[model samples]
Target: MNPEAWVALALSLKVAAWATAINLLLGTAMGFALARWRFPGRELLDALLTLPMVLPPTVLGYYLLVLLGKRGWLGGWLHEQLGITLIFSWQGAVVAASVVAFPLVLKSARAAFENVDPQLERAARVLGLSEAAVFMRVSLPMAWRGILAGVLLAFARALGEFGATLMVAGSIPGQTQTLSIAVYEAVQAGQDASANTLVLITSLSCIAVLLSARWLAPQRSAA
Candidate 1:
């Protein structure tokens, strides 16, 4: 309703967009790999990738802080080499959201790839198409709708990411406070009107995204 609320909502959209883009790129690759490959430890790797979906957001945030805090091993290296600091920053929120949203995309993309007919793949290979060509022209086309459904699913998850985003990004108003955080603070401060506005926006955004996902992959809707 106010300028501050507008800023948080805008920031949330920006962060969620970036996070969803990153998830789509990496999740599609990993999901396709897992679906198409057979190797030792594959099951273990899949479980590890999917762990975020089941973990509490606070727990995930704590791990991110441990891994990316200024004095942390990876964080220290990043700061020293690249001058990149994720802690208490919007970039950190993107990372947090991406982590939690990853499994959704991966689950859908993997299922899409798995559902592709093996006969079609063999046919493409026999037609002299390279592996990449077959995937791009055949496999990807066939599975694209499902992959898109997965992408929207991830985007929706990223949009409302709160606990992990708050821990790493610190809810710094215009800088890092997302819609979820805005609603949270509004409630805590007894600004019921503001909280209700934020909640309504969030509810609509989620519904729009989920409906888009369903429309994208009607045949494989996650009923």
Candidate 2:
């Protein structure tokens, strides 16, 4: 394998790993909240959460670029306050992947949280357990299999993310180039061997993620 290929692979792994980690945390929280709480705009929030999944990736990318570009509102504020810039960087790729993968995590986790028996939680509360404690001890453990499935799904989505990542991160080799970007670049440059190699790796990773998710899922009782 070419050294550049290795670099691309490493960077891709870094971005995907970080994206998955952040999404797992945020998605789980959002899923729990959406499942357990009622508030104004809750329905709107749910719709928006799933919107990215339905929207064209290019459109999503364009909007994200506008929102997070250097001169854009949040981007400018972040640049000034934190001295950090997301545009055309690996971090930007991670953000894009996270955005695209979030819905998968949120949907699975929300279903899992909803399926959890509220009676268990109530009993824990009656036993003097705080809400947080009840959630940590009873709810989370009971839903662990589902949460794991969601995390795996999100990780797979992150690994395969392309359009938004390309638009925001710009396929800069050694900086923002990921496996999907590398594959595209290789094909564009007529490097079939490299493209094939990347494709194989990505396909295998996706399969692994899917299989792992299935294996990790809780076995259903035979009816």
Predicted model with the maximum TM-score: 1
- For model 1 the TM-score comes to 0.95
Question: Which runs in model 2 stand beyond 4 Å of their true positions?
Answer: 215-223
lDDT of 1 by residue, 120-151 (tens): 99999999999999999999988887789889
lDDT of 2 by residue, 46-105 (tens): 999988899999999999999998789999899999999999999999999999999988
Error of 1 at 16 (Å): 0.8
lDDT accuracy of residue 174 in candidate 1: 85
What are the TM-scores, per candidate, against the unseen true structure? 0.95, 0.94
lDDT (CA) per prediction: 0.92, 0.89
RMSD of each: 2.8, 2.6
